[model samples]
Target chain A: MFHNDGFHALDRQECLRLLAKVPVGRVVYTRQALPAVLPVNFSLDTDSSVLLRTPASSDLVRAIDGAVVAFEADDFDAVARSGWSVVVTGRATVVTDPAEHERLSRTGPRSWVVTGEGVFVRIESEMVTGREITVPHSTD
Target chain B: MFHNDGFHALDRQECLRLLAKVPVGRVVYTRQALPAVLPVNFSLDTDSSVLLRTPASSDLVRAIDGAVVAFEADDFDAVARSGWSVVVTGRATVVTDPAEHERLSRTGPRSWVVTGEGVFVRIESEMVTGREITVPHSTD
Candidate 1:
């Protein structure tokens, strides 16, 4: 669907596809009654949940576990004057089962930064939305 | 300040400086009690406020006006394994006064998409924080 403002709305399937193409994104969560954003490398789980690996004691885990959060990823071309952005918003929780954690350790996204004793956090894809801005071609 | 996970914290002055270097960012706000994020092109006002120009009737204007929002901008090099991200959290208000609107129309950011009757929304920099990840040089 195209909006009057030149943004073309993307479907859920297309949003997930675009998400898989990027390795890093920003996670938005509430901090001190205000919004906070952090860039992190993430991957999609088998169930299409947004998966993140961070230090077990990191502030992110403390703030986002059992809380609603938003994950956003996008790519843009400055010269082309176009880009697409995808956002997933849902409740985030820490994966506590040892077996699942071990499984994710082997298959999940590799942490961009070095860390010790990492834990897996999953943001359920309850809502996924995206938009694309395309440059209009001129017919001269 | 450097965190154990390799993130070097940046001060407010540096954060604003980095924000001025980018033309685009993601704005995070609450929509129906869930977080929503959208990519936007913005500029820094003289008082270091985040300035966004969008259609007057856009959803973003409705969702963020007089609300706390988060604006984040970053630049990263996957191959170099280095980047910096700056986030500004503040209250956003639409410029309603005709005089201020006219002044901003001449000095504010240009909307990335074509729009009719643009409105300027200013997000005050109440809290500015950032982090940088630098590739550590090996000492063999």
Candidate 2:
């Protein structure tokens, strides 16, 4: 359904489907009690959890472990003035179990940059919301 | 200079230049003490402040007014595995002065959607940082 402002609200299933199509997204987390955002490549686990693989020593892992964060991804066409955006909010936890780590290492997202031993951070898909902007039909 | 992870750090001037090139970005804020992010089209003011125009009664106007917020914009080439991202953190204030509002109405960003009377939110460019990911040269 379209909101009063003309944005179409996307259902949870649709949101998840759209999210899996994109390889990169922005992670929102708190840094020193203020908001910080970083663009990272991510993947969705079978259960729909957002998965990120980064250097175990990266600052992002330190800042977001066990913290409530938001992940957003979108595709926009400036020339066509149409796009869709999805936001997922949930608690992020670092995967520590060696077996799970090994499984994720084999199945999770690959790091865009090669670094030291990699770690996996998972954000539960607790809340998912999305909106789409459609160009109104030309009256002419 | 490249960081240990091979990401090139962008200076302030370069960040602003890049920010202006993108017409849309994500705004990060705190909602119910958790991070929230939304895609917004923005422009840089003469003083380099991030200016967003939204419906005066929009939820974003209420959530970000007089609050610390983060704005981020980036462009990436998935095939080439390269891109740059810039983040700006600062205080967001609603433009209330009638003269300033009028001036911004003429000079600020145009909303992607048409709505009721619009309000202007300016995010000071207090802390700006960015990084660039360059595809590694083929050793072959």
Candidate 3:
């Protein structure tokens, strides 16, 4: 990994690739003005939208829709002292149109919760960015 | 794990225990009024406060002092369909007291970032809560 400035700045493609590689991410949302982060098992749609399934009646389901939120995923090598983290800031919209619902159902993610329900929310990336750190070498 | 009032509520002691077990966590802070979650390697202090090391000039270190932030960590068993996530909402304070600083240096977390600096911030938990889901025996 090469550093663009001080930290490695990942391009759009690499960011999407990393997002697809990790099934679990934490979604940060503001509810009643307090920031809350929830772990979600999500999928990356072909169009590069982050898709997640939650129950229709859940508060998370209601809070994320039309709200600006962030989804983050990372994999770290603790022993090597390196890792990559990607954060996407976006606005979420629930799939309510029948055609979109059918299409998403065929490609959207499944929930990790035991009694998982089938309410799908798609977060369209408004700003996608990432940073990565590599194991330090003596010569560098 | 069993659920109380439809959510698995973890007690204070159990929450701190789990916090110590996990070396990595995500710290959620508001940056320019938007919520951002950054992965952090943290340590639990004897007083049950969460501590981490970041550079003095870093935005996180500067913004978090006296601000409310959330520290989250979790362990999940995918195939078993069970896991617990703990969220600690607290106020962050920079370690400035010399005697306390010396004591913390012996116990505070070390940074994972290459060329790690030693600016310490302690997050005192005001509210601790967790949720867990168990395996489903019935096929849906």
Ranking by DockQ: 2, 1, 3
**Clash counts for the predictions, in order:** 0, 0, 0
lDDT of 3 by residue, A92-125 (tens): 8888898888887676775665364467898888
Give residue A10's lDDT in candidate 1 (0 to 100): 92
Q: List the residue pairs that clash in candidate 1.
A: none
Q: After superposition, how far is residue B129 of candidate 1 from its true place, in Å?
A: 0.7
Regions more than 4 Å wrong, model 3 = A1-7, A114-117, A137-140, B1-7, B114-117, B137-140
Q: Against the native chain B, what TM-score does each candidate's chain B reach?
A: 0.93, 0.93, 0.88
What C-alpha lDDT does candidate 1 achieve relative to the native structure? 0.86
Model 2 per-residue lDDT tens digits across residues A1-140:
22655578999999999999999999999987789888998999999999998777788888999998999999988766689999999999999999999898889988788565678999999999999996572221
Using DockQ as the measure, name the better of candidate 1 and candidate 2. Answer: 2
Listed in order, the DockQ scores are 0.47, 0.52, 0.40
How much native contact recovery, as a fraction, does model 1 achieve?
A: 0.49
The TM-score of chain B in candidate 3 is 0.88
Local error of candidate 1 at residue A27 (angstroms): 1.0
Query: Candidate 2 DockQ category?
Result: medium
Best-matching candidate per DockQ: 2
* Candidate 1 C-alpha lDDT tens digits along A20-39: 99888999888777777889
Pairs that collide in candidate 3 are none
